[model samples]
Target chain A: MHILIIGAAGMVGRKLTAKLLTTGHLGGTPIQRMDLVDVIPPHEPQSEIDIHCEAADLSTPHTAPALIARRPDVIFHLAAIVSGEAEADFDKGYRINLDGTRALFEAIRHTQSYCPRVVFASSIAVVGAPLPYPIPDDFHCTPLTSYGTQKAICELLLADYTRRGILDGVGLRLPTICIRPGAPNKAASGFFSGILREPLVGKDAVLPVPDTIRHWHASPRSAVGFMLHAASMDTAAIGPRRNLSMPGVSATVAEQIEALRRIAGDTAVKLIRRVPDPAITAMCEGWAPGFEASRARALGFRAESDFTQIIKAHIEDELEGVQ
Target chain B: MHILIIGAAGMVGRKLTAKLLTTGHLGGTPIQRMDLVDVIPPHEPQSEIDIHCEAADLSTPHTAPALIARRPDVIFHLAAIVSGEAEADFDKGYRINLDGTRALFEAIRHTQSYCPRVVFASSIAVVGAPLPYPIPDDFHCTPLTSYGTQKAICELLLADYTRRGILDGVGLRLPTICIRPGAPNKAASGFFSGILREPLVGKDAVLPVPDTIRHWHASPRSAVGFMLHAASMDTAAIGPRRNLSMPGVSATVAEQIEALRRIAGDTAVKLIRRVPDPAITAMCEGWAPGFEASRARALGFRAESDFTQIIKAHIEDELEGVQ
Candidate 1:
């Protein structure tokens, strides 16, 4: 099977690449050739499969047509500007997220007599404030951010293109990846992972919002699993509604702290500092607290049931199980 | 107030123009100037207000900017390729429906210190089959047609732009305009108007779907009222969710025929021929039957409560009070 992975330089992209390489096959088909693309060149891993890594900006006019020339059997589109940046730069956000995605879809349509499976990484950001406690799978998307708007628009395009038989597409609206294996960043939602990731590693982390603040989450491993399943699963079941809200564990900030304490001892819990920033607090109120992702669950996608398993996954995958 | 009508040649646009000229004011403000634009030059009307008619295509790069240069106080964006044509030509549909709308939004954003109320014409096509009998305001859009997909995308852009303070915008998901005053067209939804219109005019009309087939509708005058209300209403009440399903009468084809018979007698009803086209029947099955437009109702947008009122409005407006 020939495969193409866009945004391969990002964290989830890198991890997904590692998992695919370890298996050396997908859906029982041997990986003969794979192309990894991003704005920056992706790391070349040691593998028996024929692999090529290239740096390409998809928003550029000619880039999409050039990428589709090889006609990969399966395409994973994960490239996008993060929420904060997209909100800050409107023109740049639409150019990369919206125009770039359309260019890729159009290129595939222009190809003669070729149909490939396209797995898109959508986000829960598609829905915004006044959301239900357990937002149902069929709830409307009234996104408040430019980033979410871009994702929602792309989801519509994905379904329309699939309906027209130009491509077979599936969009997975991934929850916030918790216990993210990296240094804490300044993103508004960073605290969700920081309070857990830093304390587990015997370092201090700031908690910007109240312990009562709840949100949906999944481990980095589970996210990659969703991507693989989306790429290989029977798409006929998806029908015209190609986008889906993925199943994940819903936990409050306090619950996340307790999970860290259970796994890494009392010292980890003490490392968390409660220095609330009202700006971030107000922002958190608008984030999706949870989702009733029953459709994805019934379709064979799975995730951790609680925060404990999520932390354990992070420990095993990122920390070599030292904790 | 200076107003711009993007689709001044369309039936709704022309009616709206006539209504504005008759009233000579909007939202308690005196009318000063008006600009009418379409793909072809709109018919010039005899009016006391300064009126300019021009031919323009919004999808062209410079067209939107040139139009925005004048900075009309209220802009009615009613231009689009109809559903049948959009489905037949993919490239043309996206270019005009999606790209054209985006271009206009961008133009308004680029204008310095300029913010105008933009009333966009969306459609019930945004939502498709498997719909609840009374589709709620929060129901997700899963459009089955290319035209619906484009409208849904534009609705997203309208909300995003409004939230960013780029422009004050309102998108009305207009129901099918019944008794549309025009020549019989090949549009699949044409039968909804044809059965009532041709019969009232002492002519024969064909009904392609079963009498039990239900759909949402409003008269042309009601549609014009919706545009006016959207343009003049206090948008602060709309919050971030700028798109709304406008209120309309929901009736089955049998109900419509009964209303026709009460007004035009058995002879007019006899003109109705039922010859079911399986293809059209399948298509109509995916159309929206009803909507719970509670939000638009609360915002003071009103429509006919029954099919009889719809037919009466058509007779009074289109037929000059002739029965």
Candidate 2:
């Protein structure tokens, strides 16, 4: 099977790439050729399969058509401008996130007699504050930021394109990846991972919000799993609603701290420094606390059920099981 | 107040224009100037207020900027490719419905220190079948048609632009306008109006769906009322959720027939011909049956309570009480 992975240099994209390479196949079909694309050329992973890494801006005219000319059987669209940057620069956000995605869909449609399975990486940012305790799968999208709006719009486009029989598509509303395998960042939701990742690695991480603050989360491993499931699963069962809220562990700051303590002792727990940032706290208020994700669950997409399991998955995947 | 109506030549637009001209003011502000724009030049209404009629395609590059250059205080965006045409022609649908709307919003944003109250005419087609009996204010948008998709996407843009302080926007998800004045068209939803309208004029109308089929509806006057309310009301109460489902009368075809019988007697009701087209019947099953519209009702947007009142509205407004 041939495949194309956009935004292959991003964290989730990289992880998904590594997993795909390790398996050497997807859904019982052997991987023959793959193209990895992003704004910056993705790293060329060593593999027996034919792998092409190229840098391309999707919003640029003709870029999408050139990429689509090869007619990859499955296209994994993981590209996006992050929430913070998208909100800061409105024009850039709409250009790369909204127009870029639309251009890609248009390219696919223009290619006569060619319909690929498109797996889109949507986000929980699509819905904002005034949310219910556990957001249902069918909750309306009222995103508070430009980034979320772009994603929500893209989801509508994906479903419409799918309904027209131009392309088979599925949009995964991925939860905020917890214990993210990266350095500290200024992203408001970064603290959700930072508070745990830093303490586990013998580094101090700032806690911007109170321990009572709850949020939805899943390990990066589960996110990759969701991507694989989306690409290979029978889309007929999904019907017209192409977008779905993915399942994840719903935990408060206190619960996350407790999970860290259980894994690495009080020493790791003490590494967390409480320095309240009112700005970040206010932002978190509008963030999704949790989701019902009943549809995703019923469709066989699984995730870590609790905080401890999430921590274990992170340790096993990123820490080489040494932690 | 200076006002611009983008689709001033269309049915709802004509009605809204007539209402505005009759009042000679909006929100206590005396009529100053008005711009009526459409693909075809709108008929210039004989009014004391300054009025300009122009034939312009919004999808054209400079059309939106030229309109926004005037910087009307209240912009009623009622332009769209009807559902049937949008479904039949893909490129034209996206061009006129999606890109045109975006260009208008972009033009508004680029204009320095100018934020108009944008009253966008959205539709209940944003939601599809497998719907709740009374779809609530927060039901997810899963549009089944390209026109619906365009409206849904525009709704997202309206909310995002509003949140960013670029424009003060309100989107009204208008129900199907019943007793729509004019000759019966071939639109699947046209029958909803046709069954009542043609009979009221002593003409026979075809019913393509069973009497058991129910749908949501509002009169053209109420639709105009919703637009006025959306433009003049204090948007502070709306907060971040800029789009709303307007309240409307919900009735089964049987109920509609019964109402017709009450108003025009059994003879008029007998003018309805039952010739079920399987194609339309299948489409009707996926249409919205009703909506709670609690938020719109609470905000004082009103509509006909029952089919009888709806027919009465048609008589009073269109037939001059002669029917």
CAPRI class of candidate 1: high
Per-residue lDDT for A67 in model 2?
95
**Candidate 2 residue pairs in backbone clash:** none
Expressed as tens digits, the lDDT of each residue in A39-155 for candidate 1 is 999999999999999999999999999999999999999999999999999989999999999999999999999999999999999998999999998899999899999999999
Q: Model 2: runs farther than 4 Å from truth?
A: none
In candidate 2, clashing pairs total: 0
Q: Write the per-residue lDDT of candidate 2 for residues A1-323, one digit (tens) a residue.
A: 99999999999999999999999999889999999999998999999999999999999999999999999999999999999999889889999999999999999999999889999999999998999989998899999989999999999999999999989999999999997887888888998998888888899989989999989999999999999999999999898999999999889999999999999999999999999999999988889999999999999899999999998998898889978
iRMS value of model 1?
0.4
Candidate 1 chain A TM is 0.99
Best by DockQ: 2
The residue-by-residue lDDT of candidate 2 on B1-323, one tens digit each, is: 89999999999999999999999999989879999999989999999999999999999999999999998999999999999999999999999999999999999999999999999999999998789989999899999999999999999999999998989999999999998988999788899999999999999999999999989999998999999999899999998999999999989999999999999998899999999999999999999999999999998899999999999998999999889
User: Which regions in candidate 1 have their CA more than 4 angstroms from the true location?
Assistant: none
TM-score of chain B of each: 0.99, 0.99
